[model samples]
Target: MAVRVLAAGLAGLVAAAGLAACTPAPSGPPVAVLFPGAADDDWGASAEVLRRELADDGYAVEVRFAGDDIPRQLEQLREVLAAQPAAVVIAPVDATAIAAVLTPDAAGEVSVIAYDELILDTDQVDYFATFDHRAAGRLQAQALVDGLGLADDPDAGPFAVELLAGSGDDRGAQDAFAGAMEVLQPYLDAGRLTVPSGRTDLEQAAILRGSPATAADRVAELLAADVPLAGVLSPSDAMSGAVAEVLAAAGVEVVAPGARWSAAPLPPEGEPSATPTPPGATAPPPDATTPPHTDAAPDSAADAAHDRAAPASVVLTGGGSTLDGVRAVRNGAQTATVYEDPRELARAVASMVREVVEGAAPTVTQGATTDNGVRAVPTLLREPQLVATVEEARRVLG
Candidate 1:
């Protein structure tokens, strides 16, 4: 069962005992897992996996969600630190703000493992475990190139592409943008790809907190201005769904490579899929409407004729293998999404915590370190896979 505590009651919950109820009075010392929020499917899945694995390893596990409130998270962290658990694994809401609460004295004798997001400006973190964000960004860019047939036809005239980067505060987001630009800058220079909106800088393209509505609004503005967009490099699956809907509403076709648009009407947004989502895969967005397929019949003969005269299809790329993303790929709404298994990430963090609790060195790849502005923290990075087809999505997500 998913456990979420209201931000207002967090202090009471911690004072009463800890954030979560332990697993049947386990024998070993207690461990605590802190996540940014319960809303994100990736964090929810990871929290459950961590709870089970840590309990199996003879540790009494307690999990808590901060509900995306930085002040509330700080309060929870302070309270958790007061109890002095054997270890604490955290995926921060605000990476820099959390550093203020995780001083050496505050985290005394407790092993701190940064989960997913790195804790910056503090040397207090013991280890960092996350996916290779730069590589994920590179894969998204490559997907756009492949979907647009740019590799085979380099002379394709001035294809207009818009870049949507992740949140500005996130270090991972910055790295991803940089990596994507490394691959895309050459095309821009050669005039193969053009930014009609001219919002190419990370500052301009960034969607605060990776908000889907913000991304959708920006794309809508671009569309209203009649910017000829051949492709859109979306940052995540949720944002991709939002952007796709805006395009679909404007009668633009969004299709993956080699995928034909389905004529079947799309199920309502956030409707439970007949296909069950596999464990560890991100959940579909609750409020985002699925984009309409290109082959759907128009309401009138005039509308049908207009559809037949529609402009070129747009190639859109996303990451985070959410269920909606898979379905969108199947129905020709999104081009591709990169898959990063959250269960694998949880297992890695659990292993590191166990190592620390058992008084052994945490196993990390040799010389894999992430500089957290203070010192080089030992880091473990997992690779992500790109899925364009439903078969590939099922295989990778499952």
Candidate 2:
């Protein structure tokens, strides 16, 4: 019965995505990249890197935001393809629905590279550049293992773990869960970790369900649950922040998988200068490693504005330099995060686009395909490093 119910749910989701599943990639510019969300969002930071690098390499790059709307994104892609660029780069907001449209017929005219987020039709996309998200999950689990010293003493029975998945529509979130599970399975098999019911929280769904408060409430509920949790598999630093607030307020020592940027691992950090604010309002205390925030009520645009205006420190993470996610890891803020140098990725894509435009075939390393509704796609996967802590960040940041 349970299996049937799950299948039905999946089918229903697919059914609702009728036109979305079969759409194909359209021909477009030498390099047209779509940003599915706001440019300033952390996830969008990667797009910026790609844009800057591609521009530096003398490529014409057109960037557009999808504004969190799938239909709008599709329309944008159609328009972009009409321009007939050599290739189109995309970070899809909804992989499944977007996959419906990424047909080779749409993409056959151009080379496509699915950035960070994996797009469905593999045959159409010539290259894929992203972090080894699965490995990131393993790193998060490993961090919990080390933090709890599970390896040293195997007798730690039944530590609880909650999975705060990113948007349900995000493939990275799904992959991160898989990666985390790979590391956690051993502990689960040994009865060393216990995942409680209602532990799998999806942020976007919560919003869609009109329960934005559920995120914090759920974390609080989990912490207060009878079973004790050793940690949580948080897909992003933002989620970790919410979980942290609840745990901190409850005086519970909770663990979560956080990204390198939020987990600045250093101490006595070089504090950046703060912009002067109104005399009545005082500056929030600096986290030294994490982004700043204002303690204001929800829906307070003024408060949100205040938080954004604060001068933030530049912590190194998410890219493979010699530095890893050092600051966040040392500060116990992040467990692990993906690091893919967009400079390298952009250069590769630029070259691939050029090849596609010149009617030259792109070289493929490891051939693989992801199923778009109509067909399978040929793909080249890029490797990404998962980093944790100040030392690791320092090692990579260099």
Candidate 3:
């Protein structure tokens, strides 16, 4: 399976090489910006890539790190907004808190490009660049299903699951959970997954640290449970890494078949979809219908969120912890790691920012609308890559 996916990825890269050559020359110095949080964060990888991509476009970039403090970030944004930059790219710590600094009146003059995360009130920002986060969740869930071969038998028993989501304060985390549930719903509803109560917030760092003893108590229950955990769905690569440590201590193997991957296109669309047939198994068509979309009004999504049915014999892992997760996959400590090409996502943002600064419609793909109370946000849904070990990493990272 790795060999086939790697071949497809290599072909896609080779094909994209030509288009890479035809990219337009830089229009001006790369836009200056401020990013939320510490530079070492797993979430900041894409932001760093955007910083580099802007420099490559010949823009003079100035980045102020606003250490996840919403108030401080707002102050920084106010200061940067006043400077009248060609554009101010930001990954807001509190998407809504940043609203006070960004008003429709103040937003028109300079390009405000939200990178990785969608800033609330899209009507206020000129453009947004991010991976298709919902798709990312679906990818993670599918990987769990695939690794455990859940689709093969409907009668298979539920796999014990542990779920550790990111801060519910972050909408992206919610979206990631939603996407994964989209895939897991069928299996879960069918009793293929048994989710213990305290699992949802199990691996959150802040929550755990805030109440160490309580958190440890819950984790201990999970650790002592006799049932084998089919897998866990952590919200990012970081959480997945933490879960891997816990599961390793518990002595269970982890496998990820549809780990995270960038939504970059293959060398050509319609490239043959290659998948292997497990012994005694009839292979599913490469283009078999992806999980159903259970379409619902965007406005009511929060209140009536789409949950999943159950699946058989699966351990689901979520989170795009990237490099660390990839390392785990390589060492066989993990089944797979979600591979999000920070470089590509960054370039997409750079291009969109450039367009906004230059007063042109952005080139980013506009997909389904996401509601964040302020307004309906048009999102760019980039595909994610799933990396299964060091070998797959070499193929995509190169």
Candidate 4:
């Protein structure tokens, strides 16, 4: 019996040695990428890109989709936490609601990043990687005003404008509305643009998740009143087409985002500075042949030569590459859509992961901090582009 016991112990020791010898030193740890909704359109594209980038950076990546199910997302997150991944990039289905599961207690040392949408009411989020949503909102509103020729013509006269806000749960939606209002409030205050439907408030105008069905139903209600809508502030590409369809059915002329663009130098920001302003508002024509009389730069001779040589080109601008947005621009249903490049966002997330894992500061172009109910979360904002025309769309999206 003693001899038998000794042989069994020796066998167990040999098995343990074999297992240890085969086990390679841990180089990279498992990383879980969780999305509140299924990888669909821009969100999906971003997730896939992040996954690929993470793998390239030497991490085992796993992606899980919530299919827009809140409970399911919470469960998936719980499961991910249980596995003790090295890090996670979570796009919450409900920013405020997911706070319970994403708390520091739940995450332990696992770093958590809020993707695109800001996770509100929580201090547990370690970082944020997304585009400038407020800027996007501003861009969307600017497109509508430009398409309607309202910027130049305040006497474009009390034209009816209907505003649409994205889903209520989305903080980005609120930011977009805020940004749009920044430019539009002046016009609205001056009686140039009016909301006949009285659905001007962000909460009142929002369609959940910018769903097409919701937009169609709500827009149909607005159309029933027979009040002409010179412009509609669409919250997103997903809802833009449905809203446009309703408008077209009612016989309203639709100017797709890229329908009319001039071969002019891109303005610094905001709406094109040189526009046909409402009669009272003084603005220069885009193609005023005479140069401004302001004192020229120090290198006036060289600058003038460079300026004359620099040919102006029509810039394609818009936010996302969603099929609806692309098709709308192609069909001239809506003006331009903001092209918040998912690749850039993906790269940001990958870079963030690299930094957080290594205990280094993530590179942020803008050191902006947003309060997510609990504490101000450090954020990185990616610059978004405006995609103007079909040809531009092909190049940008492809």
Candidate 5:
């Protein structure tokens, strides 16, 4: 299985050589790995991984972080292009904002791989390599379900859930929430889970650019609204931490005691026609299927809210394999986090780069292509793994 997936991942790189063979040979200049945010914990981790992996493949790689400035990143990118590298891998801060700077005309015809984030409205991108973010959301939902003992005890009262998402501009947030809602919406529909603040839209749940401060502010609003929360759908560890912090400040615990969970299997890929029936759900009748779910959570959720102990944590889930996220899972603050293997991403991107530099026609038959409002960019995607327990998080992340 692993071998097959790896081969599929390299399909685009394999084509690169053939297609670009007519072009002049790529230069001896070092390749550039650009990050939208250099100091960011998650992006930094992936950048480090890329550096090591690409170096091992004999690519002299130079990594640059675009520190919170749009023009700065563009300048840095232009500078890198000035050096005449064979290819460049970029995870842009603003997908649309960076499009003009990356024009092959301006950059002097370098092959560019859109890493992680999709670069939109342009034909400059050669390939898009990222994990199935929607799968990340599904994993988050499943982990939350398991952590709350919903699947373990169907009789367990429906839990109150708060939904949060990544950047609104990001396709990842769209896909993640869409996928999460696919698994969780039924529960919302079936009276198994809910959002107390009634904020279901990805926009309402968004944490700008995965900003912790934005998440904290939203969480504060939820607290001010006096809504009870038993579970939260956090897209990344940073947002999870922010949510956790505000709850702590409000004198609420971050992890419920005596909580136990086992990982649940995910639904099949390619968006299964019919997702597995949410645990404890019943097939609706042909008529009279609507339940007046006026309130977000049921009576039990309110009960849990009213009789909270001095310190009690809520069930939470996130994605990414950043150091903080891994430690949170290990320490039990986060019930689970989906780890989209960065090593695989690096390997595939590196392979794609090498092929492009060799002037090959890289064809990617694997993974889905996302239409970036202009053209469909071929993608290489990997599935993320759920890390629930301290032991599990440590084993995988350490």
Candidate 6:
């Protein structure tokens, strides 16, 4: 799996190099793509896809990376906007800080598309193309419930779980946390789940910048205090890996990734289930018609028996189907990670650019609006998938 991942990355690099080397002078309408950094695998993939797709559509595409420096990103945006390109697609380093330069007048006639991350505090952003973060959070919580067999065995446990939210400054992180809590809260109230650390609030659970060290420290502290956790709701794949490491080092048995565990059958249509619904809300439909679980355990029977006997088989759930995250899932370190396909997002943005450039309204399958502290920017939010098995990871990550 690692070899395959590496090979794919190498192929991408070669393709990018070839594209750069063979580039001709700009003869088509100019389009600028500015990203916070190329360090993130998802972002890098998105940038490459956008460049190729837009160029194929006869646009003069220029892609820039800011190395996660807010000032550098600001400078790049300013420089790009100065050219008065037909369109500018950006994923900001700091959503709030970038608003200073992404004003209506500054962007003039250029249609600004906020990619991946929303650019806040400005009304100039024309469209947003990204994943539905709140839905991702809800999926994470659902994965935990399914992994622990909580839905099927509601009376089996007041299982201890830890909550780890993302950076406070990031709106997507907050939305994810909120969405997860919405699904988990009813379980907590019904005594199906418990938090031993007593840190349930978003503010309390948030790790600044989703720092791995912070997450590791928190997990270590929990272990030191002998908090026997059955699961952890991690905001991202990076933190999930960190938390799993801490658990492993402390002698906790993490649930074997991709192992089959029986999932509770979905309730009949228009019928209520054992789980209680919050007031003024209807229960969410089952996440899948066919859950990720298999009919039989993937490992040996003895190993399955040992897992059942283990006092704490921690089920870890994460977001971002990053290479490291997929590797962890394949190796039985993390149970699952959400797959938000960057290529799909980039294609959406590319299509939007084409429509806007041709003076047509952008067509969105899932249309919504995000208020960027000035006006509600029209947005197209794509749903993400959950990856739990090596085969699933291989199929999606490829």
Best by TM-score: 6
* TM-score of every prediction relative to native: 0.78, 0.63, 0.69, 0.73, 0.73, 0.79
Candidate 1 vs candidate 2: the TM-score winner is 1
Q: Model 3 reaches what TM-score against the true structure? A: 0.69
The lDDT of each candidate is: 0.79, 0.56, 0.61, 0.70, 0.74, 0.80
* Model 1 agreement with the true structure over 1-398: per-residue lDDT tens digits: 12445654776867656534653568898998989868456678779989899888678888999887899889989999999999999999888898899998999999999988899999899999998889989988888877777777756656788999999878888878887887888888898889878888899888898999998898788776556567899869899999998988876778664553222244689974232222122334322242454345545544433333223568888887346676667666788887777888889889999899999999886788999999899999888877887678656545
Model 2 RMSD in Å is 19.8
Displacement of the residue 153 alpha carbon in candidate 2, Å: 2.4
Candidate 2 lDDT over 41-158, as tens digits, reads 6446656777665665556778888877999888888787777677788877766566556665666576677766667734565566555566666666666666555777666544
Off by over 4 Å in 1: 1-25, 39-42, 257-310
Q: What would you estimate as the lDDT of candidate 1?
A: 0.79
Off by over 4 Å in 6: 1-26, 39-42, 258-310, 365-367
Candidate 3 segments exceeding 4 Å error? 1-30, 38-48, 121-123, 196-219, 255-316
Worst 10 residues of 3 by lDDT: 303-312
CA RMSD (A), model 1: 13.3
lDDT of 6 by residue, 97-205 (tens): 9888987788999999988889998888888887888999998998888887877775667777889999987888988999998899999999888988888998899
User: What TM-score does candidate 5 get on C-alpha atoms?
Assistant: 0.73
